[model samples]
Target chain A: MGKLISMEGNQAAAEAMRQINPDVVAAYPITPQTEVVQTFAQFVADGRVDTEFITVESEHSAMSACVGAAAAGTRVMTATSANGMALMWEILYIAASTRLPIVMALVNRALSANINIHCDHSDSMGARDAGWIQLYCENSQEVYDTLIQAVRIAEHPQVRLPVMVCYDGFIISHAVECLKLLEDKEVQEFVGEFKPVNSLLDIAHPHTFGPLDLYDFYFEHKRQQIEAYGPAKQVIVEIGKQFSALSGREYGLFEGYRLQDARLAIVLLGSAAGTAKEAVDRLRADGLPIGLLKLRAFRPFPSEELIQLLGGFEAVAVLDRAVSFGATAGPLFTEISSALFRADRRPLLVNYIYGLGGRDIDIEDIQKVGEELERTAERGKTEQLVDYVSVRE
Target chain B: MRQVLLAADTPVVVANATGCLEVATTIFPYTAWRCPFIHCAFENAASTLSGVETAYRALKKKGKISQDIRFIAFGGDGGTYDIGLQALSGACERGHRMLYVCYDNQAYMNTGIQRSSATPLGAATTTCPAGKLLPGKSQNRKDLTEIMAAHHIPYVAQTSPGRWNDLVSKTQTALRTEGPSFMNVLSPCPRGWRFPPNETIKIAQLAVDTCLWPLYEVVEGKWRLTYRPKQKLPVEEWLKTQGRFAHLFKGDNQQVIEQLQAEVDRRWEELLEKSS
Candidate 1:
């Protein structure tokens, strides 16, 4: 059994980083994500890890440095949130398309306009199409476990794509929780040594990365990258199973809580799922057949499996913390509706764009969503296809 | 350009910015690079190579890497003098063991002769056209080599491709430097400057003779002039050779020409003071 310790999400992430002890970590401090790099810096200073910690000027250079290091065939990592991630937008695509297999810890936060530094999914949600495998964690323990597994997923021979391990900004990042910690030896053994394919340092075989791809071959290269996701999904499942054996905690593409034969269900991501689970339990006591589907992996989106799971539900509500502007609904809502469009038996789906700019979504707000799902199930239709929860009318 | 790497005893890894060299060399199915090359994005060649150098250090310490390797990054003026300055400055401040080379063409030649900060004051670019209303680019060029020298890195040099011996020697010195080093090479563009393809080397040589682009190197914060023309030529000798500055010689534009010469003389005096 692993040792149990009390730590915050950022601390747990730093501890995981220390255990892995990657070759390079280039990062700049951003709100809610600062503690992770700060603690890692401490680890480097104290000689606990042999990491070349680069105190970069901006988030743009941080990601650029990681790309350079990763292409040179080393395990590289960084952390950022909100506008910091926004600053890394251009390099993010370069890192992914180059197949660098870099791992990043992304603390989800609201983007600017009102200049707030609170929890929201707008950051990572905006980067969904950048071709990174994204994993959302609910609590500190999941944060620890997912980061360790992310290294394996990203560096896998079949995957070899960058991974973003995300958690709610202040909700999970600053909140303390009791979690099990793995030993340094076990983690080192699990992560093993990274063997770079066509590393820039390889003197025998020279390779060029991120070449100019015009009309003749850009489409084919992108198609190959898209197909890599197929193998990545399988690798994620296998790595999850391996991680469960080590930690004795089960993980999958998505977790279904009290979902067997659930008539009314709500699907969401990140820490809000924990609150929705509490609302599910309270409503289950009132004899309502309701449950929650908390997504763990957002990229390589488990679309077919989600379609099968929601097919049996009488009514399902997709809760998103980020808005998609003029789209039919939020990001997750659009994907869910599209997935179910081809299903033989589809549920009455509704979207609730809640918790913008870190607005509170308490158990009460989620319970109301449960009740609305139940009502839609009874009526066999939704009064409104898109709505907002915990918002002023 | 590849000869510099070929001259080295160790393996070379190149990180190039997105510009003419990157696009024209590496097509999808074919690549002209004989060694490892990476093009991360525009404006990040220095930062990317910093990462590569950092990885080299880490792996060498871990005994995973045994062979000696050198890292070099290449960027045009747009990537080096403008958008890429922050990344380059950070890499230099951190003292990464790499060499950054800026092929200074003075304009965004790959983007159809657009005006860049490196474009000379009276040079006519597409964006800063020398029309009847405006003579040419109103602002003076940025002094990037001096800016890099301020970083106090191991080596910093300003050379032109016209002087093959000076350019080759400076490149060797930059490659041999232990810490961060920078080189600014004057690369004339035929299409952008509206000069004959055969006159590229001649224009670069004229730039050196006119004191417009002096050849100098700063080693360990001490400046040294690499080449001093026997007798400095008039600025008009260099200006008349390129069509970009031809308008400055026309009616009413003579003042612009005078202003260009004054700025160049002032910069040359300052450089001489530092070198002495």
Candidate 2:
């Protein structure tokens, strides 16, 4: 039996990484996410983890080192957030495009200007097309859970792709909660020894990576990248199931709370999902037939599962933490809307852009949004559609 | 069209990054960049290539990778000199059994002609655009040969495509070197330099004759001058041929030209002293 320990999400991610026993943990520190690397660095310092902890100068170098370390044939890991993640922007695409199974823990934080280091989804959402398999965590448990699965998903022979496990800054990153720590032996068996497909370091059968691809072959190579998506989706579910068996917790591409036998539901992802779930519980207590759909895997989005889940609901309040600027709706909202395009009886979806730029997202705010959705259904009209939920003027 | 492919007796993987070498070599699919060579294109090829070399070294240490396989970074000047310098420095300093081949085209030609430290004095690039007040660039070319040489590295060489025999020979020598070796090749950019495509080799050769670029090597702390001109040509001739330096002679900055020649002479004398 595993011992239960209360820890913050950042610690959970760092602990999960430690248990994975990566060869290199090259990372830099950033706000709301600093503790993650600090914890790992301490682990390296104390000789707790037999890994090379490359404390790089900047996020660019952190990722640069990861590329080097990973290409060198060692299982490598790193963590960063917000401005730090933005700094690693150029290399992030390379890590995925090159198919290096480098895993990164992205502590989700808001981008600056107004300057905030609180919970937000803008950072990861900005890197949506970077080609890495993006996994969003609902809470600290998933933080510990997803990280273990991320390694398996990323290192799969069929899906040699980098993965980013994102948890909202401050919200889940600093929020203390109970996390079931899996045994190191179990994780070692689960993740296994990562034998890279065409590793740079493999001298027995020397194979060159990062070749000069001219215009003629660039597009086809990119198309081949698209082919990995299907395999990646399958691997995520497989790893999820495997993880669930090892640890007594259910895992899926998505989790539906009261999704069945409910006329209306609130669709959410990341740490905000917990807040939404609380709102669902509160609404249910008052005899409201409302539920919450929590997104676990984001990259190869579970569009079919989303369509099936929403098929029964009369309407969906897509609580998106990130806005698409000039687009029709939020990033998650847009994807959900498109997923429901072929539905036999489409639910009236209301896009609610909330918790933006590290704003505090109280469960009461989610309850307020739920009330709005209920009113939208009852009056056959949607007021304040595609507006900030509980945002202070 | 001519095609060449060969498999090594041992596993040999080459990591090439995006630059002129990448663009010129890889057109892909139809003219697929694929070769008997297991070539990978990394964004910052120097670091990526270094990573490949490091990985190979670690594997070799563990008896995972074969001892015979060659690990190399087919990096461009921009990738090696500017963008990926730190990684290259780390790899070189660590003495990884890797060959860092820098196709130094003088400027960041991949992203459009911008002045890199490798760009020669008085070259008109997009960044150092020609104007009435200033004649293109005013800084001297950074002696990367000296930079790597200072690292006390086992092997470092300066080669130019102008001298193909020397370039290929330098490549061979670097490959033969037991430890980390860097080959900085003067890969002439006809497009960036605003010269006729046919003049690529001629311009490269002229660069050497004018002492703008000298062919030499720093092997195990010993300097060896590979190619020296019978008669040192005037720097003006080398400058006048390329449109990038057209503004230099057209203006009253004859002093700048003289200053450039002086620095070239100083460097040449220093190289000669070391070679002797």
Best-matching candidate per DockQ: 1
Off by over 4 Å in 2: A42-57, A64-74, A201-224, B1-12, B30-43, B57-63, B66-70, B86-97, B109-115, B125-134, B146-181, B189-210, B214-234, B240-253, B265-276
On residues A301-381, what C-alpha lDDT tens digit does candidate 2 reach at each position? 888877777975677899888877899989998888898987877888899888877777898988888887888888766
C-alpha TM-score for every candidate: 0.99, 0.85
* lDDT per residue as tens, model 1, A80-185: 9999999999999999999989999999999999899999999999999999999999999999999999999999988899999999999999999999999999
- Please compute DockQ, using alpha carbons, for every candidate against the native two-chain complex: 0.87, 0.30
Candidate 1 docks with a DockQ of: 0.87
Instruction: List runs of model 1 lying over 4 Å from the truth.
Output: none
Listed for each candidate, the true contacts retained, as a fraction, are: 0.84, 0.38
**In candidate 1, what fraction of native interface contacts survive?**
0.84
